[model samples]
Target chain A: MAKIFIIDDDEQLLRMVSLMLERGGHSTRLISNPVEGLQAVKEDKPDLLVLDVMMPGMSGHDIARDIRANKGLENLPILILTARAQEIDRETALKSGANDYLSKPVTSQELIEKVDELLSQPNQKMMPDRGVIIGMFGLRGGVGQTTLAVNLASALRRISQQEVCLVDFSPSGGQVALHLRLQLRHSWLDLPPLADLDWLALKGNLTLHPSGLRLLAAPQVPQLATEPSPEMAAKVIDLLQKQSAFMVIDVPRLFGPAFMAMMERVDIALHVLTPDVISVQTAVQLNRLLEKSNLKFKQKSYILNQVQVDSQIPQATVEKGLNARVASKINFDPNQARALSQGVPLTLTSAKSPLATMMNRMAEVINNRVAKRSGD
Target chain B: MGATHFGRNQLIHMDMFTDAYRVTGRVLVGAGGIHAELANPSSSFLELKDAYISRIHQPGEIVTHYKVAAFSKDNINFIVLQDRREGIPVGTQHGRSIYTRGRALSVFLTVPSFEISGEIMHDGKVAPREILVQSVGRYQLVFSAKALASLYPQISYSGDLILVQKDRIGIFCLDG
Candidate 1:
């Protein structure tokens, strides 16, 4: 449950709001004065702050403005409570630093809904500054990174408008097409010689999606020659940026020119692992290899793809062994395999799916980073 | 890039579509006083008539605080006026203009809305100027000018300017 702090002068209103939040399964800390509320926030550092506009000593607006001005609390989401619903007043409150403004006499339902919305919104604090690139590979085979990748991309798309490119770079096991259930139109192997590849040709080569996104599928052929080189992969990334924005390269697990080249461009490298010890051991080796490369992936970690709710290896052990944050944990869902077999990204086909939601959150953390960097 | 300044606090600039007939200019008269000078090309000779600030907010592409004015006969009597406190929505203002049967220009606060016939007025007096007068209530006015140039080719320019005054409002200048 999330921790919430309420600041208001009205005793009745404070009690009512506190009760409302508690019923929603959230912990609450209420303050009758604005000054004390600000002090509590600095000292206690609650997950969320609900501020009342009309308060004793200092107004909610003043307290909110102060919190926003404070470098440490600037990113904290502040819900301003006001009696006036005037357009100018709301606009003024927003300009001062409030993330959201509400008129007084607000219903319990509205308060809870607003609070839930604020909390669900990935804390701007948790947002990573760079796209965390996760590469999924199986111990034996068919571990399902393609499905995870597509669904993860879709989930991220829903959260924000950042452009996401899903690259089917898997050399032989390139099943992104099979997972998305979309017929493969073109592949890197079909690409014109690297010398001739430009923005126009790149656009013409990659299918422009109706969703205003782009995808580069891996060649369907098996064991064919003329794979894209590391240099070509770098060039493709450059060209991809010109065509769209963020990219999710479905890199082959086996190391090669393409894999090494793509790794160079990645900001956050995520190695997908499963519940098995072998998979975990493989992830450890991969992390060590990555470190040998001067820790190329700044925040490198393994995602327990298709992890069962009751896994043999506890999350703590995995985190300690990997020496990296678990980053994200996707519990096994019955529909996950079905979603993949049906060739649909879980995020789009079954957004309500629990596994899909987790992946989407993961993507959100990554997308937030890209957005913050660009915003900066 | 062309920009059309809507009633104060809204600046619309056209940098999207490419066309020679694009509208570009800043309304100098806004707030409580009028002080408009053509910064680029250094001169304005257009005239306007039946100018007024509307209280309506157009729903679609054009979001403007309209300034409707009649063109003087020569199209060189440039008039600029400021309506600082008059608050009007686009729909109501446009509806009122329609009821009054006035030729109105929908100033797309984000882009240029009108094309002027050449050799327009530069001074703020020659063109008919509509000044919105009110401190906290709705107000609108019309000033008519003679048709200045009926034979000149039609030209369009779009630009928005920030008007600094006692009251903040978008400014529009017209030349006949």
Candidate 2:
């Protein structure tokens, strides 16, 4: 029998669902408050999560996104049970990262069947002992580094069916949390000094995304310019690697101890650039710096992003100037702005778009590299 | 690619705008070229940005310049530079010539199995062996014998794999 956690604001419906699940020989835990339910799920690590779309404080959609964002609970099967039965609602529920969507007033048989189906599906394999670290960095702003980081994490979660943690290392205002529209109850700022941080302390500071990607967001406000020291950053990354299958870090433009620390641990550093003279120039400089630095990584690649419709430089020009082939090129899509504004990633908003397709392709490449590393 | 004409009477609404241009009306540019025209111009020139244009333009040259354009949330109309010079109607070019936003590449893979190095029930006796346990085809737990042999030479296992029935396992440390 699987342990199922159900979160709904309706007390009567909650009890009814508990009874139905219990009748199916499944142990059920009910929570009327979405926030409490989130905490309980983290601690309990249930087999399945039955979420309601419309909650008072936190909607089921947001809750699902949050649960998906946690590395520890990335693979938890979620069945969305809500009263809003519109086709669009169901679509939104699934897009928000719910495994299954079931309308409210579900018959006991229907509920049981759906739950059984979800439970019967193959559970994601546990994370390997070692994890792969991927760092996304761009010297120039608006090169789509944060967007790539968020979508890459989402794509990795989808392709690998594994836990992927996205750490926002931007010094100023990082947009990782903003892109996902995650409300920050906790952030890296909450952690005590690096000397005092442990697994528990570090884990508590992460904000979960519903895309099955955990985020370590930058401080909402820049205070004292407080950032992790190199040693502390390494320790945190090591800990995150232990907990997750892959850690995708969004490194800020600033070159500092923390950035160097991340670079040292990263398996691959994706130096993001756009088809612009300034972006290409910065990338060339960054490449030279990486070559000269003592820090080492398994692989270093350049990703050409088409952030703007107008290009000031051609890909060939960029390749020739940098002396490195562009490993990947992401096409420009108008829907990206909409997705960003709506706080949903384009990968989920328009999966078939060329942009999403390219992101998925990149995720596949990373997965293969990780598998190769594991085999070795 | 040549300019293709859209329906003459069709009025599409465009709502998104960039610093250089404003998009009005829904124009679906497919892989194949279509014939279309902008009924009006919001500005004096329409500059198109796309892979082809970016490749062809000189370092400082403006790409896809047009004259007499009008833009609104519901509609866009413009005249191409060539058409305005020749007093001919502007037409649609290849879809590839249109400027659009750029994206980033990502990769994903199947979740890997946990490697546990600990004691498991072997022949009803507790023994230490390093094994990789993965849930396959629902909830069946399978152990890798090769992993065990490589890590623990003392334990001899004949098969390359072992299916651990729920009751056949004993105490084990996941991280060990």
Candidate 3:
């Protein structure tokens, strides 16, 4: 049974709620005063908290805000209980960081069900006014992370109506520029030294795309495997974020110091994997590394990139192996190969294509998410 | 790394729960809170939507999940609620108005598998026998009550208020 803590001024209500949950086979702690209740929530660290809206000194909203502020308790699921079922009251509770709410007259079964539902969910606590960096990479070669990067950047450029940049961070060279057909005149190699590389200097090295998207292409030669220093990589990413409203990085699967520095600034990491045994195992290992390491992406997960019409393994099997849901799934497009050779993104050339439509929709979602999260 | 969360398909699953986990546990399919089935209070059994049964040892894990389940009221140990004023069932009244004055004292009662201790607010007299004889309800209020296992004291549960089955109380004690 889950350890549930309830904070309410009404002794009768507390007893009723406790008994109801206990029937559902959960152990509960009932506190009559708000002050003691808050202390117990912090010290005990229960699986969930049910708080009352109106108490003598501290309201439920205030307690929620305090719990959210506490570093260890920030993600604790809080259910607000209120005598007043007004819309405004709910709004207040949620703003103070309540996961869910129920009005005063609650049934025994309903209370049990809500508590279980909240327990089943993972807490998604997002801070306001933050920028986003979307990184795309696959542990196994030929899994289509570069393709996604190029096409997504093109689609985002069209949809966002704002500056969008696609960066190829492969030290040993990558297919990003090949897919975009950009001239190999400038790359991250052309940027000035780290201390001198301001946005203007970096801007001069970026190849401008016809779609108003910019490209920070990788070096043309595989022999010149010169990876940027961690500081240099962080500075470049920071500058890129300041200049562009949206940025997509075609990351190479190298968990070096540079990669770690860049990941610290990446808000989302989309680890692409094809439907195959080797690909799924590689993605699983990558997920384990991301979870164990102090990597700083808010969302470190994977996207299922279906490259073959007949995959070696099914999506269900892949999900079972990784123990996570695919953040997105992209089906293979027949014409994508021709588009890649022509140095044009599929999203730019074929808006009517299924792959292009998916990219466009994803771009729209990312755009809205960034805008809302950035507090626009 | 927590519970497996689906992007699109999981949302549809939650919508199914929204159907089952209504505020009243009654499937209010129609607008303005109307039950999908006609209410029959005269029946012996109560209906529960989306009932999940779990063992006491592994309460977090479900042994069986049901889309619907029925329970006979006569078999239930007791019922509890936050407020008695929501609507006193066709049974006897327990609470006096908030404006009335009362003295609080501890009471202990026992039912089938558990022994319960709670405070009762007596309005007029403090006589233990007179309080029990004068009470009119089959269900009595036990505020801040804790139920301990009759066999194992280590296993205990506490709740804010319990509308206990007064008729099932095998033993009752009142503190001076």
TM-score of model 1 vs. true structure: 0.50
Compute the lDDT of residue A47 as modeled in candidate 2: 91
What's model 2's interface RMSD, roughly to a tenth of an angstrom? 24.9
DockQ, per-model, please?
A: 0.01, 0.01, 0.01
For each candidate, give its TM-score against the true structure.
0.50, 0.45, 0.47
Report the lDDT tens digits of candidate 1 across residue range A1-376: 6789999876887898899889866899988877988999988888789886544466666787788768788678788775433343465566666667776657886787667555544445543444333444433244556666677666666666666677777665367766666666787777777889887776666754445446788766565544568888888776775544456676677665666777776654556777666766777786667667763443444666664656768766776676654545677787877877776677766766767877765665556545644654
**Best candidate, TM-score:** 1
- Per-residue CA lDDT of model 2 for B16-115, tens digit only, reads 1222232221333322211222212333322222111101111111123222233331221111111110112223354222111111111111111112
Error of 3 at B2 (Å): 42
- Tens-place lDDT per residue, model 1, B125-164, is 2332332232112212222211111222221211122121
lDDT for each residue of candidate 3 in B48-159, tens digit (9 for 90 to 100): 5544443332222234545566665445454433332221221224644421236778999887767789887677677766766665444555677676656556544444
| Candidate scoring better on TM-score of 1 and 2 | 1
Q: How close to the true structure is residue A20 of candidate 1, measured as C-alpha lDDT?
A: 89
Interface RMSD in Å per candidate, to 1 decimal?
17.7, 24.9, 16.7
How far residue A39's Cα lies from its native spot in candidate 1, in Å, is: 6.3
Q: How well does candidate 1 score on lDDT at residue A81?
A: 77
